[model samples]
Target chain A: MTDMSTRWKRTLCVALTGISIVTVAAASASAGEISVWVWDKAFNGDTMREAGEIYTKAHPETTFNVDDTASQDDIRAKLQTQLLAGSTEGLPDIVLIQDDIAQKYLQSFPGAFEPLSDSIDMSVFAPYKVAAATLDGKSYSVPFDSGVTGLFYRSDYLEEAGFTAADLENITWDRLVEIGQAVKEKTGKQLLDLDMNDTGVIRMMMQSAGEWYFNEDGSLHITDNAALKKALETYAKFYQADLVKPVSGWAEYTGAFTNGEVAVVPVGVWITATIKANADQSGKWAVAPIPRLDMEGSVNASNQGGSSWFLLSSSDNKEEAIDFFKTVWAGDQDFYQDILIKRGAVGSLLSAREGEAYKASDEFFGGAPVWQNFSTWLGQIPSVDYGTFTAEVDAAVAAQLPTIIQGGDIDAALQAINDQAQQQMQ
Target chain B: MNPALLRRGLVYALLSLAAFISVFPFYWMIIGATNASADIIRGKTTPGGALFANAATFFATVDAPRIFMNSAIIAVVGTALTLVVSSLAGYGFEMFRSRIREKLFALLLLLLSIPFAAMMVPLFVMFSQAKLVNTFVAAILPTVASIFIIFYFRQATKAFPSELRDAAKIDGLNEWQIFLYVYMPVMRSTYAAATIIVFMANWNNYLWPLIVLQTADNKTITLILSALTSAYTPDYGMLLFGTVLATLPTLVIFFLLQRRFVEGMLGAVK
Candidate 1:
């Protein structure tokens, strides 16, 4: 009995001590380390690390600790939970936030993020990037990457269809469908791959016309939104023409283009790395400006998935973080060139377009200055205010996708989307 | 062919189909671990020559030793604590005679109906207030008192022979001694079953650990693997390799306790 009780006591003692040791070890992050939370190691994580290294070299007192051990959704859940719990202890000094969902955080948790506009020059970034994190005339983020939309197509496939790169330039969605049909007939390959669960194509189409699911006042704008109606119609046109190879997830979607099963990929600049990953596909892939909607205000350029870095209001090393941001992120032009070349990261700094890396032609894309073309389009991407309920509206939009592609009434679909979005917003 | 023989053949075919359905994903994962990311994305089901390269990438990208150690510590410690706490409650609820015992057990079961999502914020607030955020303790603590495990143990305890407790008592054993010496030894199979269940749960736990364990060094393999999958260009081969490694511990535990686990499920005393 004594032996058993002694063993139990010893075990309890060891466990309690072990827990305390862990608690102590975990609680002690050094004073000058500016911890950052980023999702992708190759893209944002390494880019931020490079910036941090530069800042550390100059300053010497401050160092960075970038944690990319959580997915974007996981990070969002953690940040949202901590913010709602009103606990700032677990949050990092800086966080990478996607542009579309930036409003949800800023509005939901006011005073949670430190406004960067006062210290950093918001004008140097693309207007659309700055506008994403701006609330009440103060921008909260340092724009990192530009998700500027481009039409990356297989040049060989296009040529086989008796079409040149010039034929794709400045085309409308309707014209693209005709081109797609011609390409399909000639090459026997689908024009593009699409996932119905993703509203990316539709969202990009609407954003090209400088519109979103919400009006200026942030109310649900669906039924009468001309841009949305046209976008949905264009989406259906691809399915109707059988130009789309129906894919389910990210792997299949990327696989379709990377494996040469599809001819074109119209997506953000961030997909450059993914497309470029297949080394053998080099010289075959060429990028052109995205096809515009056939509307009065619609442009050829649009935005997709981009993110910006926000300083936490609870940061202990605020001045150092702000200085690091200003010195490396906002001021460094050559740094942008390095990340672009190494990681294929497209920065939102407008000045980076003038850098030598941007002007250098790539043999990969048949010696075309694809980066230059992307930069040119980057300037023209129509900015839209992705309201707080974009995610909710996006879900509503995605739910109606199956019916919409089957020649369902666009007006009726729009009404359903609107009703669903309205209910979700509440 | 004879109808009986034909039916037997059909059953064999169906059983084989069922077994393949159950095992194909594991086979695919192992095959994927040996292939390149591009090959996997291309939907290649056959093996390739990228196993070493994939493993090298995974090791270079992740601190595999530290990560697995963290996972092991959480899983082992959590399993130990959950078995002890929940089994004790199970034993007490079954062995002791209290007027409100059934009502209290019912209340605990009722608490199980409340989703973890609803309680997460409050739990976070509590841990943050305790200055326990980012600690393994925080990750392990919340899961140790799992209501489902307690309920599972209580049901298993009903099958526990109470006459042994009476025997131990008559042999001059106190309540604590009876629980420690007689009850625990007799319920070894139950403990074995709960060990696998709790260990697997602790090992594969995602959301709570993701929220609590903020540092990269402190993160578990499950959290890391999930993050790796969401990378801009995920190396599927390397990810599958990591997954295979993460799965091994649970697999070993399940296999080691296989007989007892089955017996325990049947009935603890039996």
Candidate 2:
């Protein structure tokens, strides 16, 4: 009985070993499919699938496996965990990463991603978008949508306050605060909705002046960053003037503007889709250039949120993935026009801005050439490095926003932000 | 009115209010599913005529059958293995009464305090080395001997009478037969309650499954609904519809096993 039991155990161990080998062998290779991980199925996922369809028509042997099963947070965690573990066996060929957080991943896990500029032309895309993901003199991303900032306002409310769309054009943050106070008094409505937790507006203001949380050498640029201090003071003036509506989260933030509780939404061009989703407010809305900071180097244009496509260095189908990206994302202008009209995505391909879809006037924005104006502003956006610690610093800034808005000293708040962010970065 | 009657009335009113507060979100979700995405975003309370449209869109977008099958297989298999292994270990620790085993059990409870996020990298490395990434087996294996479930069963086993095991032993029953014929039949309510809890947990499991299961076709209902909600302009109607469907299995499991759940609680208390 003992001899039989020993023999059984040995056979079972051998069988388990054989099974593990087969599973490992099966996992290592996917014959021809180039897998891409994207977050939004409606926007990036379906768009990439369409791009894949376009590619497959030319080369039948190659196929695309576009997986949008994970959230952006999930993708970040998965990528960070897998890359940190030094395991590339299950990593996808391509993944879509947001523009602001791209530097964090690139710097943290160096050589984990394939630098695309070696194969694709970096200059064909918007300069600001390209500059976002470029690291150590090498560009690494295929720029997707442009989050070019725009001042989307209700025309009826502005007119009720005796102001025209021209009054909103190329205004400064201080001037906008004045306009907001006046509009609130005249129309009895809030001028803008602000989420205290979100530091997008502050970042936009800082970027307009070509400043970031980090200096050129990636040191902490807080406490003495003139542009950021000015931006915070400008942000405080909104609350001091009593012209902003305090809201929380994406749903409430967008709801405040869409339901007409607020007059203006100075946000990314991607909000065009959300704004346009309310078809009843179509002709009532119009777009203008986002306000700049009252600083020496500030411009009227700044960016909010955008993302880029990255190829993994560990990808087995690296060559095909790059070719697929070049053919559809980088090379195709008509593809940009299609996605723009269909999904309201503003692509960053500079040449695509001259496409007919961009030039066509929209009746929604009161028949204004909104796309044309957005493209023009896209070029004027100052390039900032968006260093690795933007997320950490943004949290620090968010922590101090409530204090600053309540008439606190900007210098004291800046010191608090610097201390907290410095601790977090460690 | 009598003061006793007044107190009873107040208690009833408070209970009703508490119940309403608990159930309002579920009601709102149903109403939102029947409304357009815009109306839902506008915070409309009234139901509209979009249920069929939302259902159609959800079905078209998600492969409901395959995804449901994947969820069912993982949840069912995971719950079964968890109940068996955890119950055996719980029984062994309680019945055997050794210092070393007790210390090992204490060590496991201590290990449970470490967050899953901190252990995810090492766990992934283990799975990747074994080439179990992107498989249901990988998702289920690590979860089969859940420390939380084992702790639960260990506590519950204290209430289990040891007299039955001795009674079965004098009747010429071996340890395995005693466990099968004596303890198993007596612990029906406990097992029923555990089945519901474990099944619900496995059904709603998200993070580890997400990290392990990579393919779209291999996704669960939770992951699918999460992806839908994160869209730039999320279709609220379809998202709520998917949520309603996703919530039904757990609701049904709870509904069926609630009687046994109460009984199991009563047994544990005794």
| Predicted structure with the largest DockQ when compared to the true one | 2
Candidate 2 CAPRI classification by DockQ: medium
lDDT of 1 by residue, A362-411 (tens): 88888899899888888898778888999999999999999999999999
Model 1 Cα RMSD, 1 decimal: 5.0
Question: What is the TM-score of each predicted model, taking all chains together?
Answer: 0.96, 0.95
Reference-based TM-score, model 1: 0.96
Q: What is the lDDT of residue A230 in candidate 1?
A: 100
lDDT of 2 by residue, A33-87 (tens): 9888998887888888888999999999899888887888889888888898888
Per-residue lDDT value at A51 in model 1: 93
Q: B80-149 in candidate 2: lDDT tens per residue?
A: 9999998887777788877698789989999999998888888887776666787787789888998887
How would you encode candidate 1's per-residue C-alpha lDDT over B4-50 as one tens digit per residue?
A: 99999999999999999999999999999999999999999999999
Q: Candidate 1 DockQ category?
A: acceptable
Please identify model 1 stretches exceeding 4 Å from their true place. A1-24, B1-3, B268-270
Off by over 4 Å in 2: A1-29, B1-14, B268-270
